[model samples]
Target: MALEHAILVSLLEQPGSGYELARRFERSIGRFWTATHQQIYRVLKRMEADGWVVGRDVGQDGRPDKRSYEVSAAGRETLTEWLREPVQPEAVRHDLAVKIRGAAFDDAAGRARLVDEVRRYRAGHEETLARYLAGERRDFPAGGDLDTGQRLQHVVLRGGIAYERMLLDWLDDVLETLLKGLP
Candidate 1:
């Protein structure tokens, strides 16, 4: 999916300045779609030019005025059309998976390197899983009080948590097989 759609969804959730949107991407949206601050700004400009989003300048007491953006009617239409399109499964592009297979040709030292890398990767996933769990606890403390959007967002976060756990488990399996010299 394009970054545009992600931005639209985020704005719909709550209209905010470019800076605010970037922070949201860093905190929540980054789990599913990642874009740098520069990218976000660039897209916002394009989206505004296309008349898909409208921006308003808001004055601040101690800072420069920030332009807050919201979805225009055209933007909502575009988003709805995109939603109706079928989503294809994402293509896998895992460099570590390729490296794991390449380890078959490496000597003892290279194998050791692979093990270390696997451990590092697993550590990252563990951290992400922890973050997802914390977010779930903080955001959804009560089960029945959530609105439809909140419930959907929580479910997506749960999917992310599950995916990270699955990757961690698979990495453990890979580490065991590699260390044991199993074919």
Candidate 2:
């Protein structure tokens, strides 16, 4: 359901073919919302059928015809309704956290591995947050009035940064606990 709205929002930003939409998803919202090319294409078709978007055949010189999708008035109304609604909090689901909770059942070496994995995940998340911050700084700057789409992106990036910082702090606490127990 959120994916459908995401597709509509992407089309509202600008008209694009399914392939282009997939690429934009990877570059922009992939930090939080992930969708495969096939999934994006499928959602686009459904959106077109539902009258949320209209696709036009775009022919390029010496290239296959591509269908570019744009948001309709209906889509704008639907998106506005969605924006006005209360947002639901996402459920937390971390497989590593689950594994770490069960680390007592593992050997010493296994526990060490879990700690290492946690550290690696923290580093990767930090990198991702850095990228988001860089993109936001480049695009929106500090005191600029952003469009609806840019505002959404900014909110997502802020969330990413907060999440990463929390994870890093948690990792430090865990590592300290583990080190204290070492012989």
Candidate 3:
């Protein structure tokens, strides 16, 4: 999906300034779709020019005015049309998986290097899993009432948590197998 679609979904959830939207991407939307602050601002401008989004300048007491954006009717229609399109299964592109297979031709030292790399990769996933869990706790606390949008967001976060966990488990297996081959 294009970055425009992601931005549209986010704005539909809540209208906000470009800075606020970038922060939201860092906190939440970045999990699935990532975009830089520049990208967000650039897209907002294009979306505004296309009549897909409307922006208004809001003046702050101390700071310069910031333009807040909300989806226009055309944007809503675009999003709906995109949603109705059939989704294709995502293609998997795993460099580590390829490296693991190629390691079969390497000597013990090369395999050891791969083992180290696997450990580092696994550590990254472990950190991500921990972060996802912490976010779930903070955002969807037990016994707390959630609005419809929040509930939907929580479910998506849960999916991300599950994905991270699955990656961690698989990485563990990869590390274990690699360790067996090392001296």
Candidate 4:
């Protein structure tokens, strides 16, 4: 999906300045769709030029005037259209997998180091996922009546949890294989 679509979807959630949108992406969308602050701002500008979103200047005391962007009707239509389209399988580009594949050429010590790195990475990701879950549970209680926005946020959170779990499982399998001396 184009970064523009992600920006438009974010704007649809609520009107926000570029800075606010960047924060939102880091907190929520960044789990699945990674984008830099510069990329987000650039996409926001392009989205405005394309008539997918409208920006209004809001001046606050002492701070610089912020341009808040909201998704336009056209943007909503575009998002809906994209959602209905079939998804293609995403290409895999895992660095750890590449390292594991190349471990055959290395001596035993080098292979052991690569396995250690993978273990560290897995532990870090697991901790991050735990944090994400804790925050979600705190923000939205299970039995609460969630509005559309809350529901959407929950869906994204679910995706993050599943992805993290898959990564953890993959890491375990890789660790087992490496320990067994199978290239």
For this target, which candidate reaches the highest lDDT against the unseen true structure? 1
| TM-score against truth, every candidate | 0.93, 0.85, 0.88, 0.88
Query: Which stretch of 10 consecutive residues in model 2 shows the poorest summed lDDT?
Result: 174-183
Of the two candidates 1 and 2, the one with more favorable lDDT, higher being better, is 1
Judge candidate 1 against the unseen true structure and give its global Cα lDDT, from 0 to 1: 0.92
lDDT of 2 at 90: 78
State residue 158's C-alpha deviation in candidate 2, in Å: 2.0
The digit string of per-residue lDDT tens for model 1 on 1-183 reads 479999999999999988999999998998888888899999999999999999999999999999999999999999999999999687678999899899989887899988998999899889989999998999899655988999899999989998998998899999998999834
Clashes per candidate (backbone, < 3 Å): 0, 0, 0, 0
Tens digits of per-residue lDDT, candidate 3, 1-183, equal 478999999999999999999999987899888889999999999999999999999999999889999999999999999889888676677899999999999999999999989899989888888898998898899999999999999999999998998888898898898888874
Relative to the true structure, how large is the alpha-carbon lDDT of every model? 0.92, 0.83, 0.91, 0.85
Cα lDDT of model 4 by residue, 109-179, tens digit:
99889888998999999998898889778978889899888888888788888889999998999999988
lDDT of 2 by residue, 6-65 (tens): 888777777899999889888876766789999988888888899999999999999888
Clashing pairs in 2: none
Model 2 misplaced stretches (Cα beyond 4 Å): 61-65, 143-152
Clashing pairs in 4: none
Highest-scoring model, TM-score: 1
